[model samples]
Target: MKIEVNVKKRYFFALLGILLVLGGVFAVYAYNSNPPNPRVFGHTINEVDGITCNSGQAVTRTAAGWSCVNIASSGGSTPVNPVNTLSYFEDFIDRGDTSEVNHPGIISFQGYAGKTFGYIHSKDMFDITFLVKGNGTLYGLSSYESFYVGLVDASVSSRIYFFISGGNWQAGTRNGGSTKVTNLNTGVSIGNSPEWFKLRIKRVDAGTIEFFINDASVGTINSNVPVMPMQIFAATPGEADGRLHVLIDYIDLKITNLAR
Candidate 1:
């Protein structure tokens, strides 16, 4: 009887030990399967504009949170190139002549307000198709305060001005005393943004020109226009208190079949 009782005690002790070992293993497995958030543990997740930033994006911490920036697509160091066949291109890096002028101050190549850009005044014009990429702010004035980029006739009285005013676009032409204008509603969308844009203006025909914003056609004008000898200008004329700032990345002029 004593031996049987001792055997029963031994068996009971062995089973209890095995059960304890199994419970410990199960506890460890459960912990490994459901852990805390990796961000909480590693603390590497970046916050952008109160939102979490994904991997491989550059970010700057703002007053509220972080801001994701396009370090790759935003700024430019190389000269702008033509997408299609071209006859002329100006990267705005080097002005080949002194014909360029800045009335209030000297023109800059280092860029304006930390934007990498330049400006120019071309003496001659090629059959025109070019992309003008930049941004500026234009204010209203009573007098003739024109901030424009486009073809200007020799007399200056006849002009096709692709200008911005009152946060709107003006595709305007003045021939002698007669004037015509087309207003585009893209100003509020384009104004005051740090992002670069592609403003393409092309001569569609002898009597017509088309204007585009980021490859989208804003408008087309049909009017009697001058020939190709028009001066390619970036100008702020008859300045008053009205302010105009245009920062250009490049102007790639191409001679397409339409130009020919």
Candidate 2:
């Protein structure tokens, strides 16, 4: 028998490449401290946690803790890992209680009646995306108990004017001649861009209501909604699907205007 020894350079090169990639990823994380959101384009017209944003969005919490943190995954679709899912915002009064988990997505304000959230998913650096199905009500501009939208009946209803809904969502059946236009845009599923699907209510008002997904608008209700809401919620008026999923990254409510 003869002794033979073989050395492969490719293996060494592959290991070196992996290390460099990891180093680059770490560097990017260390340098960028900003989060993905709607105003990444320019300026927005809303407030997060008592502060108005001239551009971009901000997320925070009260006496408890803040949810929605950065995570890495494989299925993430954008600037983040495609599989990353880390928007778990919650506030439990007691450490051993899980009751507060129900309203973790809801934010409370002190003086103002409006709320906002900044979120993202694996798509283009966003980590979390909001989703909704069937007839559900979401309040953005106005969170008072008296405000809300009608239903999710997409049809030839003449009253279904873009400006008529005033940025609110009306969920119902167009087959019937019944629709709840409400007095303003309260309970409407909202997103930021038309690309946004299954979303969260942005701002519901009697003059202008907006909805967003991944912090972008997908639909608008821009009529009669002039009311500004401080509280936001999701309600189901019909059992078309019988369930609603208000997937949110964080909820910011303004009890007082810290910016003003």
Index of the highest-TM-score prediction = 1
Question: Alpha carbon lDDT of residue 41, candidate 1?
Answer: 10
What clash count goes with each model?
Answer: 0, 75
> Estimated TM-score per prediction?
0.42, 0.24
- State the displacement of the C-alpha of residue 173, model 2, in Å, after optimal TM-score superposition: 17
lDDT of 2 by residue, 61-177 (tens): 445544332232211111121111222322211122222222333221222111222211101211212332211233333122222222222232322211114445432212224
Kindly state the number of residue pairs that clash in model 2.
Answer: 75
Q: Candidate 1 lDDT, tens digit per residue, 66-91? A: 45432221123321121121112233
Q: Which sections of candidate 1 miss by over 4 Å?
A: 1-145, 177-189, 193-195, 237-244, 256-260
Q: For model 1, which pairs clash?
A: none
Q: How does candidate 1 score on lDDT?
A: 0.41
Let me know the TM-score candidate 2 reaches against the reference structure: 0.24
Q: For model 2, where is the 10-residue window of minimal lDDT?
A: 119-128
